[model samples]
Each structure stands twice: as structure tokens, then as C-alpha cells.
Target: MEKWLVVLGIWAMCATCAVLFIRGATGGGSGKRTAAEKGVRPASRASAGDARAALND
Candidate 1:
């Protein structure tokens, strides 16, 4: 019936979307980098001496 056809079409669309989403989520074809790999580093914790120097400024 037409209703069953509609349901099948919708199901097919959903399956396609899920496949694409999973592929993208897994980075199938593109190069990806982590923060460290991109040469980004987190700032080190400030020491007490650094705080004193800032207060003196």
C-alpha cells in the first residue's frame, strides 16, 4: 500500500542519515588533529612568585 511505501521511504532515509552521520563522526576521509598535535599547549600553572610580581606591577 501507499502507507507502507511511505514508511519504507522514511526508513531508508533514516538509514542513509545514520550511515552518513557515523561516517562523519568517525572522521572517515579527512585528516584530524588533536590539540597537542596542532602545536597547542595548555598554560602552566602560575607560581606564587609570579603572583607577587604581578601585584608589584
Candidate 2:
């Protein structure tokens, strides 16, 4: 009975860890703001035609 209790405790701990990890990885309920989501564009962004023009010169 003691050994079974220990096994059950370990299993419960592992399940809790898995649930927390999955929640964190999926960003569950975390109101994080990304650059794109905030409508902020990077200065270095260029189109393919601009890159080609620069390379040909």
C-alpha cells in the first residue's frame, strides 16, 4: 500500500508538470504583445524587388 501511494504521488506530480508545461508552451491566457500584433514594423524590412535592385547596381 505504501509503494502504491508513492507511485500515485509521482504520477500526480508528473501530470501536474505536463499540464503546466503545455499551458506555458501554448501561452494559455497570457496577454503578451508581439511586434506584429502591436502594428510595429521593423526598419530593415525590404521587398524582393528592392533587394534585387540593390544587388544589380
Candidate 3:
């Protein structure tokens, strides 16, 4: 029982470490810009009309 507990503890620690390592390697969700940060403006009707006209040609 003691050995099993030890193995379980080690496995849990290893899994936690792996998750932390992967999160750090992938920038931990901090690198992506939010919609507000990216300055995404709403498209105007005229702009959409122009895009449709261009696409048709």
C-alpha cells in the first residue's frame, strides 16, 4: 500500500509538471490579443458593398 501511494504521488507530480511545462512552452495563453486589443472595428455597410462589387468582377 505504501509503494502504491508513492507511485501515485509521483505520477501526479509528473503530470502536474508536464502540464506546467507545456503551458509555459505555449506562452500560457498570454500571447494572443483579445478582440479589443486587436482594434477590430465593425464593418460598415458601404465597405461590405464595395467588397461584394469587387468579388463579382
Candidate 4:
């Protein structure tokens, strides 16, 4: 009846809101980090030294 229709409409609205919220929280796109841009390089001693110095401070 009419009551069931109302309940269905509310349910659909709530589902839509939940989907939008999840997408917003997760950044909604590819979340990959490139090698060069991913923090300090492994082979470079100078970069590692700088990181250690910063951490000590």
C-alpha cells in the first residue's frame, strides 16, 4: 500500500546517501603511489641521512 511505498522510498534514499558517503571517504579513484614520489630512495645515502636527522630533531 501507500505505507510500503513510503518505506521503499526512504530505503532508496538512505542507500544512495550511503554510497555517496563511502565514495567521498575513499577518494573514489586510483590510489597508487609512484616509485619516485614514494618517500626517500633506498640507494641514496644522503636522503636516508636527512630522514634520520629529521627524525632525531
lDDT values for all models: 0.66, 0.67, 0.67, 0.68
Across residues 1-57, which tens digit of lDDT does each residue of candidate 3 receive? 999999999999999999999988886544344632565533542357757744633
lDDT of 2: 0.67
Give the C-alpha lDDT of model 4.
Answer: 0.68
The residue-by-residue lDDT of candidate 4 on 1-57, one tens digit each, is 999999999999999999999989986445333533565444544556877745643
lDDT of 2 by residue, 1-57 (tens): 999999999999999999999988896533433654665544544444657644633
Write out the backbone clash pairs for model 2.
Answer: none
Which scores greater on TM-score, model 1 or model 2?
2
Taking all chains together, each candidate's TM-score versus the true structure is 0.50, 0.52, 0.52, 0.51
Per-residue C-alpha lDDT of model 1 across residues 1-57, encoded as one tens digit per residue: 999999999999999999999988887533334643565433542334657644633
Sort order, lDDT high to low: 4, 2, 3, 1
Lowest summed-lDDT stretch of 10 residues in model 4? 28-37
**Whole-structure CA lDDT of model 1:** 0.66
Clashes of each: 0, 0, 0, 0
Give the worst 10-residue stretch by lDDT in candidate 3. 28-37
